[model samples]
Target chain A: MYTDLVAALDIGGTKIAGALVDGHGRILVRAQRPTPARENGDTVMRAVEEVLAELTASPLWGRASGVGIGSAGPVDASAGTVSPVNVPGWRDFPLVARVRAAAGNLPVELIGDGVAITAAEHWQGAARGHDNALCMVVSTGVGGGLVLGGRLHPGPTGNAGHIGHISVDLDGDLCPCGSHGCVERIASGPNIARRALENGWRPGADGDTSAAAVAAAARAGDPVAVASFERAAQALAAGIAATATLVEIDIAVIGGGVGKAGDVLFEPLRKALSTYATLSFVRHLTVAPAQMGTDAGLVGAAAAALAKRTDAAAAGV
Target chain B: MYTDLVAALDIGGTKIAGALVDGHGRILVRAQRPTPARENGDTVMRAVEEVLAELTASPLWGRASGVGIGSAGPVDASAGTVSPVNVPGWRDFPLVARVRAAAGNLPVELIGDGVAITAAEHWQGAARGHDNALCMVVSTGVGGGLVLGGRLHPGPTGNAGHIGHISVDLDGDLCPCGSHGCVERIASGPNIARRALENGWRPGADGDTSAAAVAAAARAGDPVAVASFERAAQALAAGIAATATLVEIDIAVIGGGVGKAGDVLFEPLRKALSTYATLSFVRHLTVAPAQMGTDAGLVGAAAAALAKRTDAAAAGV
Candidate 1:
């Protein structure tokens, strides 16, 4: 049984989330602070320290062993540096070392938030008990992590489960990754909205409507809305089926805000799988909505620290 | 340095290969014997014992510490039982315990041949140094092993790299595994030859024809032969490109007798990849021929044993 507490941190585009979690994967104390955007590494480090200090000051932080930080894209966990594409300020940031510096000299574990989300699913959510599966979040931007063969697959660059970048439409739109027809470009929220807007489906006749609103309209008999979401769902499912085929993943966990579309998204996606499900081994592959909701990153960060503590105890290191 | 040696065995439909390999991943002696048709598990075990004894009697077998066997499909590695579909008379055969008994108490390891081949590729083949790739042998039946994110992936049933079974066409063809549109069912060796034979094409006008003969005929201006091979190539390429998109594999190595179609296959396969690569990730993927040739299986068997022995040694068991 787990007997120690861990420091879990989530680094986002504009904020940092920190929490002290018990061995049973429970959050004891939590703190959140804005990231020092456009600032140098020292400023960002100070922000993270402040966030961790806030949690450490809590009486619940007693006996905590180490820290785990989850950051955004293009991260390198092997080197414990974050190279988030959206936050250029974090290019090659020595995140683990920085967290360790303020963590009373305990070990620091850094991983991609997507990877953390996947691990969280493995440790506490939909992907539990399945050695090979994917946790895909289709929100502001699509991000995912892979749990393959009972182990997390954080690539040499810590970008193993970058499914959004997978191509589903060769002649589709261009993606931010400089690729044409990426799943993200053709299926993410922005793409969905862009397609809807272009096809004359106005959100409040052009308001701040999200993909959820579009899904609602689709269900309410809006043809353009249905068309856009269906198209996105089709693209995502094709990519998912392809992943399932290649990795032999038994299940796919879809998270993020867009997943609330539920059947509106899943039905078309399943149909796409049916179209591509000729392979007996890969057919009838399951896709489900993620269970941990917005807290997946937090749960995953805790899991990473918990894993290190577990490993250390096992190794007697 | 290799302080221990393990006898490695590979059981395939066509051949049963055995090798005496040291712990350092080097093979000291290697030999092969054909697998008899409809040979039951008991008979195969007898052949296996003979092969092991021949190797153990050799000078290279002096240091072998254990035995490891990698066999064809539907095998239960955990229980050491084989239920290979291609090799009849093996109904839940206790292959592991049988091999262990034959080894006279040597530590035993059993896994899928795909896993072994992938392990071999990781240890010292085309996939070496590259963490995310797939090793495929497109012979009698298409089989594969996956190396994802710097580690080998063996699914819950130890069948993660069952790439050939992924459905490429829903209404395409029926596979032996009771699945329709499997990559293997559509594009594998027998299927390729069957397509050629069923197409009513003369193999270069009165030749004792096979797939290779048909390829020759196609090269020599047989319209039907060219179309048959092209269709097979296209299906295989679609499967390959789809895999690349999902797994982000940098390279895929094609082996087996069918791969002997050479440019006749690769050229059209690459063209299909170019045409059907929905994502840039897939489009840029590399497909190559396996470098280790027939030695791959034997080497993979060695690699599997190496992992087992090394893990045991590290565990201080």
Candidate 2:
């Protein structure tokens, strides 16, 4: 099984990425296309088709045994459909069927992008050796997935580890997801920037008001910037602690733009964790930066495909 | 294995209960003793031994094939130890080893009391037939267990579903467990009574200030009493919602004293669930009163023993 290759797609609101990946997790062929996200579902499917066409043009395409998709979600893995919050036009899109058809009717595996990243981390990155882990993307919108008891826990809907939307503060700020005090509302990249600006932190002459700007200011000893990151860290700590308590995860891997803030985020995050992760079994949990880079989604999709194929073969399918 | 009986024990800070349970989960024989919790660990073990001695003396004892124990936790099944918070006399006590020795070297299984209840719920109670569920006991202190993918998720240390201590309000009041705004601190029976009293709700001439008294007051239209239950309901809803969001549980079964508050708790809890459980997959989650009664711990311990023996036999161990 490890000698075979899989065709993988990482579909997001911004782009469609496809790769032919060997079982070793190395991409042997790659292609990309801008997503027509605002267009109708068919148009968005066309862009994905174009990416698949490019991948199929490669000589390595013939060697691929299955197709795997990691898509921005509300994915219904049971129904083989997706409705990404960021891709309104693709609501309830029949993604698995489309990908399977485009990939020469090969067996297809579909999972939410968060779960995909978790698969990648568990297979070859930060969570590689851990039997239970949480891998998160603390970006414009916080998202995450779980690896429980050494398997990808995508759940029935491929959306089990949607940590970003879980309320850490029952009485805190309202989130766009219609919940109040969600982890993403406090800890995402935009939230970090918003809190900093709300607290009277100003950007430099560059006029960049992103979380990165706040990170730079915090590094230069700006009190307001530091406080904002600490607040975000606090919310993240509580959410992570709650997750660990519920599921017994041993490690939390943080990625995305905000996570890359380095000490500005990690230092405060480590400090706040001690306050919330108080249980005897959970007290030993550690947080680390995610080692998977931008290609994580594609690699993770490939991993899921390989896993499915292996399971199918074992079942004598 | 359904033709064989098993020995089951439920050990708490207050009592040691033992039973010779048949394969059908019926308690054919029972024994119990008050726990000398304030005494040394050896003294506490004596009470357990006495209970076991009574069980061993039963006419049906020879039919028991295995033993299972559910103890007040922080229990480490991997290390065969327990250090229950309320039982200060036994920290890291070798409970499994002690039980194994006392049970004539028969195969033994151990799990946290919460997990035991969950096993009961999953096996034959409200969560029956559900592939994923959270079963909770909302009594003097909130405790819970999980059944994921059709099996009891006791986790590596037999303490997976210790939901009572997970903080829902990260910045709220400090919990005795060293965290803040834990579900237990807000929604447990004692907390309900304490909060009702703190908010100027008084007891009647009989001087009963228990949560059951508060429940009676709420039923009789006492606004302060109603509000106290509402607050507890809100915290419970948040915690349940968080659990559903993280693990994709389809239902949450509530048992124990506060759960017996009936509509006074359930009505508000059902209403509050919608406010926090707004995610796509989790929005459909339901809450119900647990069907298993006072003997859930014993029945669940028996279930665990049966399951262990079955698995061991399958593995040819």
Candidate 3:
């Protein structure tokens, strides 16, 4: 059979999205379900099965040679399991095997959502032309992925770029990850909102205390909101510089809610980067907003699937 | 002639060493010269030429197909230039071209000294069996390199794993590299000695104020010295954990002066690593003393040369 398509599943705590993607990374069929995250593992599995059923129902599914999953992680690609912290019922869940069985035994490849996003960015977004780059999602949580030597570097466990948890301030506040002063602790959307509220940045008539609201206030010249975003930018810059120093990335592509803060986040981020990325090799590092939008995870997953198919074919498997 | 040997040059601030090494990593000829680092760039180039001349005098040199140079960096392997921090005479010096010319137009490859050590470690030392590892030199100024997916990851400019400059404390004291709270600023040999001295720890009878002296004091139950080493260990741990979190290294091989401090450094380092390496993928990351000794740089440079030759052969060049 001529297989020119691949199946992709982007599984998160709030949603289970499935799609059949063509060789050109276009989605020909799509399905999604609000995750029953609070339910038992089996119920969550059923939701995934339903999504797969919707995908399998499409005539395009016949062309899918393999399945690729981009799930909220820590994903153990080596072991084919997923233990997403937000998905309480899915600790060490055999996601790959279950998904493979549900999808008529198609070969399955799995990676962390951060790595998947990187694959998307490297394929057709901000990191497209860069051989070494970092792609980040700064929403309620800060997560990231790396591209080294022009390929996605999803380490052995598919979680090589968990930048959020790396400590930038060793003696700073203890993070929920059991680390002190993690980038996510200071730069995530929730953290940005929390810091702003703690520092007397009040919400308007809508009573919205989200980071977006804080960014709005910062845009309007609110000192407290601006300070909070600046602090977040500092942490993000330190983490980004640390990443660039360690792996020699030339660019960092930022996405997600906090990344949408535009100049408020990027200006301070670029300035703080100058403070940390002082080495000769890292001095040229640049930051840009991500181009991949809502369907990044799906497209990234499909990219992984296509890559696996190519690899298998190359190896004559 | 059947080419089975590689010529290696290990260039540092204090010395220039060269060798003709066989495919089995055994050195068949050796040469050395004290670096005229304070002299003009031409004089420094002459010293390197002198070392190469000595190696070329040996009959074993006839079998060498390529020459590898491992210099104190920042080296631009892509541009064939070097601007080592300690060697002020060389600023963007064309070391690769000069060495290639001096070595009878042999194919030449250049990498940082830290990367050379990592190649050595990955080829025959502590990181030999581990596919993903970080090898470091915690000496006067800390430096390091990485092995990813069982091969050396000498990023675009040959300085990927320069972990010493990565910030562990974003707001801490400034480093010579113009960064704040870099690992080298807190965990390097000089920093350890400086911190101990500033904390009112008096040198012993011999008045040795080096990090080795501080390690001796820490071993002898001096509280102040112990605290200094502990602080240095904390910084090293945070940096190591950060490296593991970013690139998924399974092991970190420590060497050089501070790494020789044994339990005084390792004990606190392991304790602090548990504090920062909280992610599942990085939690299993282990720290070990580097197995390659002073000869590491020479061997590692040879390893790079051999690798280059092998690659060329594979590509039918």
**With candidate 1 superimposed using the best TM-score fit, by how many Å does residue A116's alpha carbon deviate from the native?**
1.2
- Model 1 lDDT on a 0 to 1 scale: 0.75
Per-residue alpha-carbon lDDT of candidate 2 for residues B1-317, written as tens digits (9 for 90 to 100)? 44489999999988889999988888899999998999999999989999999998988888888999999999998899999888999999998889889989888899999999999988889999899999999999999999988888888888988889888899999998888988999999999999999999999999999999999999999999999999999999999999988889999999999999999999999999999999888999999999999899999999999999888887899
Tell me how candidate 3 scores on lDDT.
0.94
TM-score of each: 0.76, 0.98, 0.98
- The 10-residue segment with the lowest total lDDT in model 1 chain A: A166-175
Over the stretch B1-317, how does candidate 3's per-residue lDDT look in tens digits?
A: 11389999999999999999988888889999999999999999999999999999998778889998889999998899999998999999999889999999999999999999999999989998899999999999999999999889999999989999999999999898998999999999999999999999999889899999999999999999999999999999999999999989999999999999999999999999999999998989999999988999999999999998988897899
Q: Clashes in model 2: which pairs?
A: none
* Candidate 2, TM-score of its B chain: 0.97
C-alpha lDDT score of every prediction, in listed order:
0.75, 0.92, 0.94
Q: For candidate 1, lDDT tens digit of each residue in A146-258?
A: 88767676555555677777555444555666544667877888778788888998776557667877888888989998889888887777667667756667888999887
True contacts kept of 2: 0.71
Q: Cα miss at A101, model 3 (Å)? A: 1.0
Q: Per-residue lDDT of A1-317 in model 3, one digit per residue for the tens?
A: 11389999999999999999888888899999998999989999999999999999997778789999999999999999999998899899999999999999999999999999999999889999899999999998999999999889999999989999999999999999999999999999999999999999899999999999999999999999999999999999999999999889999999999999999999999999999999889999999999999999999999988988887897899
Question: Order of candidates by lDDT, top first?
Answer: 3, 2, 1
After superposing candidate 2, which stretches have Cα over 4 Å from the reference? A1-3, B1-3
| Regions of candidate 3 where Cα sits further than 4 Å from its true position | A1-3, B1-3
Q: What DockQ does candidate 3 score?
A: 0.88
